[model samples]
Target: MGTFKIEGGHQLKGSIQPQGAKNEALQILCAVLLTPEVVTINNIPDIVDVNKLIKLLGNLGVKIEKIGKGSYTFQADEVDLEYLESDAFKVDGRGLRGSIMIVGPLLARFGKGYIPKPGGDKIGRRRLDTHFEGLINLGAKFRYSKEEQFYGVEADRLKGTYMLLEEASVTGTANIVMAAVLAEGQTTIYNAACEPYLQQLCKMLNRMGAKISGVGSNMLIIDGVESLGGTDHTMLPDMIEIGSWIGLAAMTKSELTIKNVSWNDLGIIPSVFRKLGITVEKQGDDIHIPAHTNGYEIQSFIDGSILTISDAPWPGFTPDLLSIVLVVATQARGSVLIHQKMFESRLFFVDKLIDMGAKIILCDPHRATVIGHDFKSTLKAMTMTSPDIRAGISLLIAALSAKGTSTIQNIEQIDRGYENIDERLRAIGAKIERVE
Candidate 1:
């Protein structure tokens, strides 16, 4: 396993550019299978999970070409449907959580789609029922193999229908949208996830000849097209990563500028960080975070109640950044409660921070109360293991701000999301190195 050796208490300078959104890249990469024409995608982050999906597509006979750094052209005209039944596919498909998305496009274009039980972060139970259930609602026959833990869907031609999702799942919405774009009639999805990532997928499909409306709303209307054509698409900056950088700057008392951050799409990220007493200044499209030399103070409610930051559907704070917020609150001037509503196990990483001398109360599996040391007490460095992608980055941020050196094992978790993170941190005067 790879590890990161970080020298803590060093202030980072200069600016860092957020990579392409990992969540959006996964959805957009799966959309390439919806068309036979050449689909050129730019700003593809060179990360493990995205690369794994790209390789999985190539193995399935999608012709992939590297046009430039963070750019790729894919053509799925000759996809080998037979490969889905092979043992190699079972192993390849199991490696990525995003591989489940390919089933929607394959079932829409071809007659069948199969996938092994996809694997990803061990945060909690991320059920695939949403994906399969949405596909089943689109006239696809769904079957599961208990012995093999594999899922398969087949249909002659999908007929569109209205669906009100039980939960506003981002991947579920994206998967259903991809399948509905090629269905026989109009498909209306209510209570859908309206995150910018899903909006990007809808827009990209529209550009490729799919009729989709309600670009940034909870309800989406997709009219089935006979076939989709190819088009160029660029991914937006990763808001989660941008939020991480903001937290990192505040925690380490650094002046770092995050460039090209698509301010309008950031939703409540900046405001949430500001609630924790961090300065998130807007410089055109970039975010400039000044050094918090005196530490930041958490804001209270208008009624003078303690601040509670929770994750919800779009327009609310993202669950992925809650870990970063928890870590940043460790050194803030006041207290804040981080409620992770989506995932149950994400708050388990607080013990590691507590080991580092941060006053954190693990309220439960879903919530954590952080009593900010206010920089009067620096976190002492310690060795730790990364449990998941967001937690890993949060730990890395904690390590960077702690006193003395720290070691983080299983950095592959971090690499799965951030591209060249250590190298990128080094560019901004951060003392981080990758150790094999």
Candidate 2:
């Protein structure tokens, strides 16, 4: 097992840069197989989830080359679809929610797609119904075996049509977009997820000759084409990481600056943190966090009452970031309720925070209320095991703000998203040591 021992209470004082987004890289990599030309992806995240996806693409006969740090040149022109039927594909597919996206691209190109169940954060049901329904709406046939729990999709030629997704599932929206990119006629997707990650995917597809409208909106329209040629595209900087950095800095009273952050893309994030009383200065592309020698005051509601920080679909605060926000809220002055509407089991980790002297009420599986200490009571750190990717990083933030040293086990969960997380934090003077 891998673990990270971090000594807390030291102010993070330095500049750090975010790696390319993990979610965007995963989607772009799968989209690579849709083209026959060389796809040069720059600023890709070198995280475990991406590594697993790269390996899966390699096994499928995609020629992958490491062009530079966090960059890759992928050539999936000769990908043998047969590899998708193998156990190796199923095993790799089980580790990521985005793996379900590959089926759409594979089916669009090869007329067939095969895979076992996809696995990721066990947050909730996370149904693939919308994804399958979208594909099925586009003239695709599906066959599933209950015993094997595997699915296969085939289509002679995908014909695009209008689709109203059951939910605005991020990966589901991405999957349908990939499948529709090569389908015949126009495809319109409503109730779409317009997150930054999905917008990047749309731009990447457009670079490859797919006509997609509504890049950052709930309605997406795609005009299918004969074939897509590859193009060089850079992955977006991870907003989630930036949010985590903001949380960590605020919780520890750190003087930190995150450089090269895509500020325009960070919609609603700034306002969301403002609710927590964290003041962030945008100096061009960098975000500045002054040392809160006097801790920031959490603002209450209209009647000077308590507030709740919850999550909804995109355009709302992301659920992937609620954990980090929750941990940061623990250090704020006022109390707030974190209602994790999307995932029923995401708030279970509050017990660990409560154990660390945090005033947290795990009201249920989906909701928790945190009473901030206002940096008065010192949090005594202890050994913790990471549960999910976002929760794992949130725990790291908590551990970094605690008074004593803490150990976080199962770094693979952490590795699935953040790129060079330890090194990046260390650059900002975080006392973290990785142990195997």
Candidate 3:
């Protein structure tokens, strides 16, 4: 296992650019299978999960070429359908949760799709029912193998229909949209997730000759096309990483510039950070966070009630950044309640922060109450293990702001999402190093 050795209490300077959106890249990469023509994608982050999916595709006979740094050309002209039944595929497909998305595109273009039970973060139960259920609604036959823990969907040809999702799941919506684009007729999806990344996927499909409307709304209308052609696409900057950098700047009292952040697409992220008393200034397309030399104060409700930050669907604060917000609130001027509505065990990392001398109350599996020390007390460094991707970055931020050196084990979790994190942090004067 890889680890990170961080020297705490050092202020970071200079600028950092957010990598391509990890969530969007996963969806877009899967979409390449929908067409036989060449699909060139730019701004592909060099991360473990994304790379794993790329390798999986290559093993399935998709021709992949590296055009430049963070750029690739993929052509699924001769995909080997027989490879899906191999033992090698069962092991590779079980490595990451994103592999589940490939089923939709394969079932659309070809006649069958199969995947092993996908694996990802141990945060909580992320059911694959949404993905399979949506595909089943599109006239595909679904079957599960209990002994093997594998899922398969097959259809001679899919016919479009209307579906109201049980939940506004981002991956679920993306999977359904990809399948519906090649169905027989019009498909209407209500209660669809309207996240920026999903919207990007819809737009990219449209450019690829799929008829899709309501690009940025909850109701999506997709008209089946006979075949889709390849198109060029560039992914947006990862908003979650941008949010993390903002919290890191505030926690360490640093002046940092986050360049090329799509300001308009970052719905409610800046405002939520502002509620926590952090300065998120806009400089054209970039975000400039000034040093919080005197610490930040949380804002109360108009009725003078305590502030509570919760996650919801689009246009609401993202649940992925709640860990970063929780870590930042530790040194703020007042108290705030972080309610992680989507995942249950994300708040379990608070005990590690508490060990570092931060006053935090684990209200339950879903919520945490942080009493800020207002920087009057600095967190003492300690050794810890990363629980997940977001929690790992949150712990790294906490270590960077603590009083002494700290060690974080299982940094591979952090590497899955953030591209070249330690190297990027070092460019901004952060004292972070990667060690085996």
Tell me which of candidates 2 and 3 scores higher on TM-score: 3
Point out where model 2 deviates above 4 Å.
Answer: none
In candidate 2, residue 110 scores what lDDT?
A: 90
Question: After TM-score superposition, what is the CA distance of residue 326 in candidate 2 from its true location, in Å?
Answer: 0.7
lDDT of each: 0.95, 0.89, 0.96
lDDT of 2: 0.89
- Better model by lDDT: candidate 1 vs candidate 2: 1
lDDT tens digits, residues 1-436, model 2? 8899999989989888888988888788899989889999999888888888888888889999997887789888798877777777777777666778789999899998877888887677778788889999999999998876788889999998998988998888998999999999999999999998999999989989999999999999999998999899998899899998898889999888999999988888878898899989999999998888788777888997788778878789988899998998887888998899998988888888989999998888988888989988978899988998998999999999899999999988999888889988887788999999
lDDT of each residue in 264-359, candidate 1, tens digit only = 999999999999988899999999999889999999999999999999999888999999999999999889989999999889989999999999
TM-score of 2: 0.98
Total clashes for model 1: 0
Root-mean-square deviation of each candidate, in angstroms?
A: 0.6, 1.1, 0.6
Q: Model 3 over residues 1-436: C-alpha lDDT tens digits?
A: 9999999999999999999999999999999999999999999999999999999999999999999999999999999999999999999999999999999999999978999999999998898888889999999999999999999999999999999999999999999999999999999999999999999999999999999999899999999999999999999999999999999999999999999999989999999999999999999999999999989999999998889999999988999999999999999989999999999988999999999999999989999999999999999999999999999999999999998999999999999999999999999998998998
TM-scores vs. true structure, each candidate: 0.99, 0.98, 0.99
lDDT of 3: 0.96
Over 4 Å off, model 1:
none
